[model samples]
Target: MKLSPRMQFLVRNGLKGFLWLTVLLAAYFLFREVVITHKPDAWVERFYARPMIIYLIYCFSEFFFGLIPPELFMIWAINKGDTWHYLFNLSLFAGISYLMGYINFLIGGFFYKNETFTNLKRRLLKDSASQVKKYGIFLIIVAALTPLPWSGVSLLVGSAGYPSKRFLKYALFRLLRFAVYGYIVYQTHQI
Candidate 1:
């Protein structure tokens, strides 16, 4: 059976996310094995020692088009070797990301009619805006669940004057993405 265009888009993006994760894990393991003569625990400790700094960087990255892949943070959390700590970190990461997206949405709405903001939105989200117009909530769902720019999509939705209530409801899927991806990263770390 032929898939609809929306399904195709989703499938393509899903594969991209999977491949990206695979490559990231492989590179990390290779570096660990070949370059790090010392126990990774030392390195992990050095970074984990500054939890607040890591979280601040993550919050910035999530707000600005997710500049960093969250899976890396998950690996850092897993390295602590404490299940509760890992879970707590993952929850914090997800919460921070969700909050950033909501903030971007409000920013978009607040600047809805500003010419400068509109120009910037058109330039940054040219294709995404069209996709948002075409796919409506489905595109938001895809962005939330996949590696698509979650903040950008949220901005587009808000600037387009989509209902805030519905956006919040759909954006909750961001948590599921974190849960699933965090679980995968944790399991791989075990291996």
Candidate 2:
């Protein structure tokens, strides 16, 4: 079967968009060393030991996204003290993750919008943006729950200037993943 001229144009445009998105994702990993590494200071470690501050610190850590497994943070929170402590940990993480995601949202919206990847980015986000629009929340939850390199996706969406309401909706879905995983950690602690 042969594609008409119009079909060809669409195919070419879609291919260009796919390639650009791949490159954008790859580029994020290329700088993963700088982009993903987090070294907690001695003071921070000491601070977590205080029991009262563990929940607050764990939330802040999620803002880094790919820096570490969220399970580790959950485990730390579960280790705190009582049911109130667990709820506190959940709240802390939620606040931090939301704020952290916003930073990436802005980074996508602003910092990476250079001539370096201009055409490709425009093609991917602009042309293929609809593909995500339908299942945005599902995707965000998956990204938050799994160990995938989802921060890049968040950044791309942000860069493309996806509406803030859409972004928050997705972030809330992702937060559920974190909370579910935290529950898992808490259960494992009992046995």
Native-to-model Cα distance after best TM-score fit, residue 145 in candidate 1, in Å: 2.0
> After superposition, which runs of candidate 2 have C-alpha atoms over 4 Å from their true positions?
1-61, 112-138
Q: Give the worst 10-residue stretch by lDDT in candidate 2.
A: 35-44
Candidate 2 clashing pairs, residues 3+ apart or interchain: 108-159
Local distance difference test, each candidate: 0.82, 0.60
**Candidate 1: worst 10 consecutive residues by lDDT?**
128-137
lDDT of 1: 0.82
Error of 2 at 81 (Å): 1.3
TM-score of 1: 0.80
Write candidate 1's Cα lDDT for 71-184 as tens digits. Answer: 778887897658888999999999998999999988777776778877888788677656766675776787888777888878778887677888899899999999999988
lDDT of 2 by residue, 35-85 (tens): 333543543466556864654455445555556555556655665567777
